[model samples]
Target: MSRSRGSFGQIIFADQSRIYNTSTIVGRIRVCGDHFTKNCYTKTILGIKKRKGGNVSSSFVRSTTKSGRRKGIRSSHADAAPCGQDAPEKDVGCKSRIVETSMPYADHDYSQRPPSLEEQLQEAQKTIACQEELLKLRKNRFFLERFQCDDRLIMFYTGFKDYITLMAVFMALQPTAESMLGWGQSLADQHIIRKGFEEQSPPLIDQFFLFLCHLRQGFLVQDLATRFNVSQATVSRICITWTNFLYCMLGSILVWPSREKVNELLPLSFKNTFPRTRVILDCTELHVKRATSKVLNSETYPYYKGTITFKSLVGISPYGELTFVSDLYMGSISDKEITQTSGILSLLEEGDEVMADKDFFIGDLLSPINVRLVTPAFSKSNRKLTPEEKLQTQEIARLRIHVERAIRRIKEYHIFDRTLPMTTLGSINQVWTVCALLTTFQGPLF
Candidate 1:
């Protein structure tokens, strides 16, 4: 008899050759006759082999055969043995082979269940809702709302409407290069004089004016382009043309008010609140793009922002009308230099009183002009001003507040609030001048 143990079950055989050919046996088999025998095969039996390729010992083989025969005899009486003794052990050994053949491979196609129409609709709704929420948040935080008012209120605000109407008219009046060239051509044909003097195209004056209006209304170039159906380049060109035009042509408009005009337009209360107040003069810095070279940049460099800028000297009458505005100057230039160079000092007459902040050294500039400069008098010799001088300084400051208000209004146009594009300084100056002109048209501040 032979015996073997495997993953599935134990096997017993009267002859090794019979057992080796048979794969499985379940339950029990009993032989009654002397010639009866049992054969079984298991995985362990197949795995058993002598090392070094030598045949197993005859004695060992005989002992294994005896053991197998005893197990077979016991198996025949499995009912009298332990419970579950009839279950075949061979099935256990076959498990690994079965799994390897039956399991899905990595590249196998999987059965997919299609999404329902209802599920797709729900997903789309969720996406739309998320988008709407995001849009709402952005609108609330970043976008400026359009104005809302009844027709009556709109009619009453004729000043605002007039300003808008003028801006629209200006926008509509922009001439194309073709038209400008034609005008030049006509001139050349009719006049027939100079040899090298070819027809030159006029700048886009109308577009530039419209650009100023857009800035005054607080719209960026991109936004203006979208609204006006023009490219950003067109918008930029218009802005540049108009800014330079206004700064150069309208510079003289911003001047100190004459005594007669001051008396006529200024409020009666101003006479009591501030005495001998001719005009309020101040300097404001506008940021600009840094020049390419350090040396050129230093010429325009502002000490405060460490960038190039234009310093504007603004003079406002007691009535809140802009009396004078200086042509844009380099940021490095001092207020006193701008006053002298810009010929604002020439605008002053004898006995005229000027009010400004501490930055303007009135003693040196105004004293020479026979005009008195009023500000908070700084303590000299480490001593405070006398009570009378302090009272006068307080009055001057209160009066000067109106000029500050005027400046605040000018700065409301965002183009001047921060560092503007280096290429657009001329345009910005033009825009500022136009806005100032428009502001004057809005009515006196008083």
Candidate 2:
């Protein structure tokens, strides 16, 4: 009467050993007879039913042949009784025990009986996920949804499209890039271009979209050609043509409003800070490759960049719109020279004030023309700026940031942000002009 209770037993039930799961079970409880009395208890197979709340109970069955042969565990009513019930051919004093617990994701070597309910549910879920992925669709990045989300994103990749007079109405409001892209698609509908000998390639929408990408991304002509599946010559041509096209389309659109117009439409930000401001002026530079000619290299090279660079002056209206952009100048040239010769001051009216950085010594120059220069106070080595001067500097800086942002928007074209090749230097002005005007597409800066 020695029972090894609560101990697991390795029952060599029927021939198959792998049909049961090793991990999916909660726990296994086994009952064994005395170790010394090997045949004292009947060796029989049983079925265990697991409940949702982690309760489990076992039922014994005569799952073996009467001839003393091995057979699989069975739960059929003909062979066994449910838990707490008796088996018809129970061993004289046999008791069954659980051997092991199961692990999650345990694979069951399915034998004769069907799989459990839990396993079936898992398979169905996986199938549904796959079917959903197969059925889903996505939009083209340039033509629809992506554009509407951020118009600035489209301007960065594909600048304003070829102008149609009616397009002015669409440009007046800041719509989602998607709506504009949709409108652009409808506008370019049925339009096409070709060269007689070449194989047909991607359409102009993609071509120009790619062109804008190349401009803002600064990808090389050879790389762009490969990406668009066009020849290097085509890439070069599109770059030059589109640069000229955009400049022609957008460059002349920026108008220098009269002083009265400026006062009438002055935004609250400028009105509160610098009411008399005609424009916020700032200078920017672009790095370029050293030129072939020594004079060209000498002229373009500047100490600030440690490399050849091009410099230009940018001015934005009080409402954060670009009103002026000087022609590209060699970096070595002084800002005053660019300002003097660039003809920007000629646009200013008497009594108009130009807000600028502290560096611009254009006050004496503007004074003669009856135009005033508003700049941050200079901190001389002999004496620091007074408290009042410091406060004026902060206010000026606050207003000046809008101009810096305007310049930043110009550089956003990315082409301006990269090292310029000598070949493209000829059209750098067009590139600059296009980027400046492209700001309109970015919605109102204010």
Candidate 3:
């Protein structure tokens, strides 16, 4: 077969003086044999398949385009019949020579039309609508329902054991608490004014829950405001209202057990060693912010803590129930001074014994009341303790540590974990008393 080039970038293949033309496009190939030229057979150049009665070898051709860069066109050779061969209409075969040509590279990317200003504004509006709906859902939900089923979370957020225990305390205070003043009213105006924006406050139970969360979690007023969907002033008023309310309500209940009652529920450990022991006493301190006044600063600063603080005396019955929580005093006061002034001595009956730490030197004060003091033995002058004295110290330490554990339980409320700010000074003492009183509802210390 003789090979020759034809016009319009076609290739001619001749067999026995008869010629056939083959045409190509950018990525395709068309073969024509002895059949009418109008009837063309198409085949893909890149992955040409083998037909029966022929063995094929595949390759590609490179030709220069107008841009002077070589472009590749795939072609293949097959050992098949010549152009004059008579073949079936479906199986027409041909032997052709390879040809090289180039065409302009086709552009693959077509950019889409940009959105108009009005359409863009519509999309932005849709996004803002979605965000407002989400915020509305957050504002309308109740905070307590999320914690109702979890006892641990209830204890963590509110210091109550579970929903039932929290509600029990709420139920005790609800009769008076639910009817309290509106958030917008000042504490002094609650009696004079019938109402002022009571409708603006959250549900009464939710308000109570918010108060507990503030105390237990040490949340900021703004944080509690956002969480309860109320203004910061509302949060502050709810906290103040509840603090005073609970202080009055819980304080009215008698926490101290009578001498006879103490004896009935006295622990076996206390009964074996000291049957007359009535209460365990200790002093704890809460750090407070430094004051602007030098005298006020001096009054609040404690030598041991090396910071401004408020000190109070706590007394637990031998059965581990909180018997008394003294009002907060200046931290600089001595343990002995707090004990004497704390009025716990008045509660002691004749022959009643008191348990305390070594720092308490109120033994002389209790002596006139005919009360005894139980404390660990300390070294006298420079003398070390003897073996018998050592054993006695160990026994007293074992018993005295219960008071420390009781104090620690009160400290676990994270509100006291940091220094008290000046802004809370108005309600700080009441908050302190309320936290101690609430510990009674935690079942028992033992």
> Which ranking of candidates, highest TM-score first?
3, 2, 1
Model 3 lDDT per residue over 361-414, tens place: 998999999999988889978999999888877877888787788788788888
Model 2: which residue pairs collide?
A: 22-102, 23-102, 23-103, 29-98, 30-97, 147-177, 147-178, 148-176, 148-177, 148-178
lDDT of 3: 0.78
Instruction: Candidate 1: list runs displaced more than 4 Å.
Output: 1-213, 241-256, 304-307
Q: Write the per-residue lDDT of candidate 1 for residues 361-409, one digit (tens) a residue.
A: 6568778779887777778788979998888778778778888778777
Using lDDT, give the best candidate's number. 3
Q: How many residue pairs clash in each candidate?
A: 12, 10, 0
lDDT of 2 by residue, 4-73 (tens): 2221332221111221212123234332111112222333356443224333323324478888886844
- Angstrom error at residue 178, model 2: 24
lDDT of 1 at 144: 19
Q: All candidates' TM-scores?
A: 0.53, 0.58, 0.66
Residue runs of model 3 more than 4 Å from their true location after superposition = 1-142, 182-196
Q: Name model 2 segments beyond 4 Å from true.
A: 1-156, 159-195, 198-202
Question: Considering summed lDDT, which 10 consecutive residues are worst modelled in model 3?
Answer: 50-59
Residue 255 in candidate 3 has what lDDT? 91
- By lDDT, is 2 or 3 better? 3
